[model samples]
Each structure stands twice: as C-alpha cells, then as structure tokens.
Target: MNTSKSAGEIRLIRLDRIEVLNPRERGSRVFEEIVRNIKTIGLKKPISVTPRIDASGAEKYLLICGEGRLKAYQALGEEEIPALVVDVPDEDAFIMSLAENIARRQHHPLELLSGIRQLLDRGYTIRSIAEKTGLNHCYVQQICNLLRMGEERLLIAVESGGIPINVAVTIAGAGDDDKAVQAALQEAYESGALRGRQLTLARRVIDKRQRLGRAAGRTSTTKHSHISTTTVIRTYQDEVKRQTALVRKAEFSQQKLLLVVGALRQLLCDENFVNLLRAEALTTMPKYLAERVWPNGSHA
Candidate 1:
C-alpha cells in the first residue's frame, strides 16, 4: 500500500522472467498509448515489482502492476528500467491489477458491471467486491440491475449515458412484461421523438407500471392491444393526418417569422428606397415608418 518513491539502480533482466498477474484484463488503448510513448521518449515511469522467495531460498522478482508499461517497454526493445520493489500479498495482486486498469482508462458502465457480476458469480459478496474494486455498493447494485433488463440494446443505452442508471434499474425490474415499454422508450430515444425531461418522465411511467406488476405478482401487458390489419391501416391513416396537420402548423409558423423579419428589414431601410405597393401590408409599413421617425413612439 506504500506508494513512496524509492530510487533504485536499473537492472537488465530477461523480459520473460517477469510474471504478469492479469495480462488479459489490461486496457487496449492504454497499452497502445504506452507503446507509443515508450517508442517516442522511452519508459518514463518504472514499473512496481515485488520479490518472491522460491523453495530453494532463491529470490525472484514479479511485476505487481504496470503490465501495460512492461509490454510497451518490451515492444520498444528496452532491456532495463528502474523499478519500485515492494512486498505485497498475493490475494491483493488481482485487485491491484483491476484498479490499475480502471484508473488508466474508464470502462463502460456495462463493462464494469459485467466485471463486477463475474466477481460476484465467483462467490465474492457485494461488500467484498466493492472493497476489492474500490466501487460503491450502490453502484454494484445498480450494475446488478443489468441482469433484470434482459435486453442488450437497453443495457447499451444505459452504458452510453442515453438513459440514467436509476431509470435503467427500473426498466430492468420490469421483468418480461416490460419488453414493450423498453422498446417504446428505445424507439422514442433513437427516433428523436422524445427528449430532455419528457424522456425521463416516460421512463418513470414505465418503471411505475413495472413496480405495480411486481407487487401484484402479475406481468404488465402492453396498453396497445394487437390490432387487425384493417385497424392497423386505419390507425396509420389517422397518424398521417395528424402528422400532416403538425407539418402545416410548423410551416405556417416559419412563414410568419420570415415575414416579420422581412418587414423589420424593409422598415430599417431608407424610406425613399422602400416600395410601399410591393410591401406585404401597408399597416406594417406605417408602423415601421412611425417607429423610425418617432424615436419615443410606443411599439405596442
């Protein structure tokens, strides 16, 4: 646990002699960056190591952390770099590796959740896992909720920050019945039809229904009943009409704003240059002229 820097002489050792604790768990980007940096400026930071005693009382050194840095050094063809040798227990080695990897590059929430779940499945309690991973218990619980979601797309949304963890946890708790609700929320989000507070509100509504279902010991059903082909066609027609009305309203508003801007511009021009007949409205022209001529005139 001691992190105090101690200067030691650089010694050349066979690269294969060092034992890497968690080689597979190392972040790829971090490893790549370390390689690049070592290729450019050499290994700036020496790796931390610990000495192990063999059966014959022979002492050997093992890398406690810095697998990425070690790989980068090896890639760069460096024979020796200063290392900090410390005595640490074997049980803490994997935890240290996990923390180092996480610190180097943040894992996606879902990825982190998966790692936590793996540890849990291996018989580690939430508290023990949290202590080992240096994550909060609440965070561990939130990640466990991913199992409840049962939908890969929904889990991705949560990991990408498109959905809040609490909202995701609610959706996960919905069991099988919430599939339609989750789908609806996903469609609204991807289609840009729902956003900001409205998206959150929709998630809350779905979550509330899910909670109710759990309490009742019954799965919640989609409110939208299956429609016959004729009914589907009729519904499509009704939606088309609604959308057409909306588009017209938007177009009208845009036209009005454009007209107002044009009027404002015409009024700002020299009075002699303005064509009264060509203007949209004589009333607007006079109002513009009055505003220009009388500085104190009430625009109201």
Candidate 2:
C-alpha cells in the first residue's frame, strides 16, 4: 500500500460514510488478523480513500482500499479511522484498490481470480493487468480460464500453495481428460518441476478434486449445513484432544520401556539370576532384550 517513500496526507475520517468498493465475506483469517493486530498494536497503516461529493454536496469518502482494516476498526466499535485521502478518479481509485488487494501481495487464488475479473469488467486487457499488477500474462489468462470454468476447488488448491502454478495451468488445459491430467502431473513430478512434499500434496488435491468434484461437503447427499467458526473450532478441539491422548499414551509407553530395560539390566548383572537362568535352560536372552540390557557388549 505504501507506494512511495514520502507519506500521504493522513486524516481522521468517519467510518460510517466510507463505502467499500469491493466487499468480501468477513471472518477470514486475514480479517481476524487485522482485528487482532489493531487491538494489540493499533492500526499500523492508514486506509486509502478518495473524496467524493455526493448529491447533497456533502463530502463522502469512497474506500479505495483497506476494507479489512476498516471492518476491523468497526468491529472494535470505533466511529472514525485514520485514512490517507487521495485525489483520483473513481476508476483509477478502483484500479489502485485492486492492485493493493490482489496483485501486490500473496492472496487467496479465488480472490485473485475475482479481482482479475473485476479488472476485466473495468475494461483492462490481459497485458494491462500484467503490467499494472506485475503478474505474468499467461498466469492471468490461466486464472481467467479457471474463473470462467468455475473451478473453485482447483483454485482453492492453487491458493493454498498445495500445487504449483504451472501444474495447475497444465491441469486446466487438460479439460475433462483425467488421464492427460495425470500424465502431465507425473511428468511435472518426474522432471523435478514438483518435488518432495509438493508432489504428495498435489496428488491428494487432484484425487480429491477428481473424486469429490469440489471441496468437501459441497456434493453431499444431505442439505449443505452452513459453515461457521464454531463448528470449525469444535472440530479442531476434537482433533487436538485425540492427538493429546495419543501423545500421552506414547510417553507412558516410553516410560514403561525404560523401566523394563532398567529392570532387565539389573537382573542380567545379578550372578544368582544368571545362574537361575542357566539352570532353567534360558541362557541366551532374546536378541532384542539382550541388546538393550548389554548395550556395550558387556558380560551378559
């Protein structure tokens, strides 16, 4: 958002009058982080707004950017916020807003796609989008195709960094040919285009997309229940509990193994016990237990 070394004119603006140019659903992690950061350290950057004269000639600010920060301040119950007032045409303001939101930073792939579509609606070509946003032309085209096809799941995977951009492009070009898609992915993996854990994640994403045809629960038999923070938090808590129990059991098992090894070492060192073992025709201890009891190749 900081376009130059010199700062812009900062002023206190009424939060209620500023209109978000491109609004999105709230409660995402970015929104939560913005709220948390404002509460923790105050707003780090002033929002950008353009001054507009309404029908009544009253000064109203059209929010060119900073929807997240604005929403966070509203959530904090603040009536006014610090903002940078910029004098620009509405169209240019929108372009700047789009640049800051989608192109400047790493964003959710879906958001980037939507923003690109918005830019296209605003009459910007692919080359213009690339020049303004600093994205490659091919990447913009691929995103446009994905958006047009409504490939939400693939877009999600791309956004999450589970698959590479090149792989996604290849898959998008593969159309409905599952075999060609698989071949392309395999070639990418074999050629070292994808490596290590990325291949595993890419496979999972492709399989899940091919099988479910969308994100989980989208194609369910029953009616789609609304997704909310509470349900997600509850599921996370359950998983945490399960993992905690498993960890505790593992620790207990480790402790028991140590105790048994200590006891066995003591018994192996006792001459009477060795004699009793000899008399019982149990001279040779099990290889596993013997290795632990006499780790240094001792008499036992």
Candidate 3:
C-alpha cells in the first residue's frame, strides 16, 4: 500500500458518474443543516473523488468522502459538482473515508466498528489501521478483539463508559464461562484496569447478561436505531416543556419561601416572642436563615 499523499486534480465532475464507495446513514436534521448552510453560503469545500476507468474505457469517479455534501447537491438537482480528483488506489480511498468517519465526534460506535472491520477484511494490519486512522494502537486492538469475540452489548457498555476498554476486552475473550469472566475481572481490578464505578458497572453487566441468558455470542437481530427529524424535534420540544415546568415550580417555591420567611421575621419582632427568645437566650438567631429573611439588615 502506498503511504504517500497524492496531489489530485480539482475539477467539476458529473454527479451521475461518481459512485459512493461507502454510504453512511445521516439523520435528516444533519442533511437539512448541511443543505441550509450550503444554500446560504454555497459549498465551502469541494468533495473528494478518485478517477477510475470502467471496462468499457469510460471514465468515472469513486467518491472518497463528503457523502453529505454530495447528497445535498443532488437534492438541489445539481448536475455537476466540484471535486478534488485524486490518483490514489481504491484501498486508500476507502481508508480515507474511514478516517473521515472516525474523526467525527458524532459518529456511532457501530459505524466506527464497521469501518474498522472493513479495513481488517482488506488485510490491513491492526498497526496499520492505528497509523492510518490516528487511533491508539491499544484501542484499535481492543475494538478488533471485541468484534472477534462477538460482544455487541459489552462493546456498547464500553463505548458508554460503563467499563474500561481493556476490561471489556478481557471479559469478551473469556467466552461464555462465568468463572473465566470473573477471573478476568479480578485480574483487571488487580491491574488497575477496573476501579471505582467502572468495576461496579462491569459486575452489573455480567450479572444482568447472565440472568437474561445472554452472552457475547448471543445473536441479537436488533440494529442501531436512527432517530428521524420529526422524532428529534419532538424530543426537543418535550424536554423544553419539562424544563419550563421545573422553572415555574422553582419560582413558585421561592416565592412561598419568601412569604414564610417574611412572616417569621414579623413574628420575631413581637414583644412576647422577643421576651421568650430573650428568656431562652436564643436571641442570636439562626444566622443563616436570618440573613435570608433580612438581607438588608432590616428585620421588619
């Protein structure tokens, strides 16, 4: 594999002739956001492509990256789009796509795992993947090890920070043997791979999985669910309503507290109450609560 960078040509290419090598599922909100920004400011950067010649000697291009931008242009019915045509091979193009995907902070763990698996399938060593993707070698190995163990749930737990990456790797490769998993967990604790809440979460995951008759090898047909634009908007609206209600409740409580404190301060000024307090030697007043009732140092 060529590790050198290619300085490709920048030209306008017909959208119909470019094929998407790896298509990713983008939420409608993301697509719309891209479209809105592009419409207002035009495209900020050109999409990347690699030139290819078909069997019939016709020239076409493979899309290396920028699926969202390309799709936005297509939605606008643009026939030709500007692209940077590179002279790299198909393998490097795929790597570039994978690197871009992994670089995104919003990318799902499953999507990242898929990209890593594709690279591995293409005979790229784990070390090479680490170097190409700029991921830590240990992290790359951990993900590959988890995939090999078929530990989907554990992988999700790891991604969610429920457990340490190394601990997940250890338990994943322990097969379905409970004793082996426990032993591995103990080893992780001893080696500082598991500590604090991470150790607790790891034990809980093991117990929950075992109780549900689940293991790393369990074949779950469930795929990652993508929320639509409508769902996202609805969720945001619901959250706003909930927060508004909480704010209103807090304001009401504050008003009630002020009323109660004000009444108490008035009662404190009464001769009988003042005499009782003087007799009991409680005249100092609870400094904290008194300050709230008399913020300006005027009791009444």
Q: Who wins the TM-score comparison?
A: 2
User: What is candidate 2's lDDT per residue for 1-300, written digit by digit as tens?
Assistant: 222222367889999879888776654787888899999999899999988777876778889878889999999999999999888888888888888778646565666777887988878888899877888888887776776665666777777877777787777777657899899888998888888888888887776556445334443222224434544676699899999999999999989988999998788789999899899998876788777778887865
- Candidate 1 per-residue lDDT, tens place, 1-300, comes to 223324353445456657776554546777788798878787677787765665666556677667767777787777665666665666555556655554335565445545565566667777877777777788666665564443444455555666666655655555556675687568667777668975976665455444332221222333223333544676699899999999999999878867775676566575643555347444444654465544486432
TM-score of 3: 0.62
User: Best lDDT goes to which candidate?
Assistant: 3
**Candidate 3 overall lDDT versus native:** 0.81
For candidate 2, the TM-score is 0.63
Cand. 2 Cα-lDDT? 0.77
Error of 2 at 177 (Å): 1.9
Q: What are the per-model C-alpha RMSD values against the true structure?
A: 11.8, 9.7, 10.1
Off by over 4 Å in 3: 1-6, 179-300
Clash pairs (backbone) in predicted model 3: none
> What is the lDDT, from 0 to 100, of the residue 226 in candidate 3?
30
**TM-scores of the models, in the order given:** 0.50, 0.63, 0.62
Give the Å error, residue 10, model 2: 3.2
How many pairs collide in each candidate, listed in order? 0, 0, 0
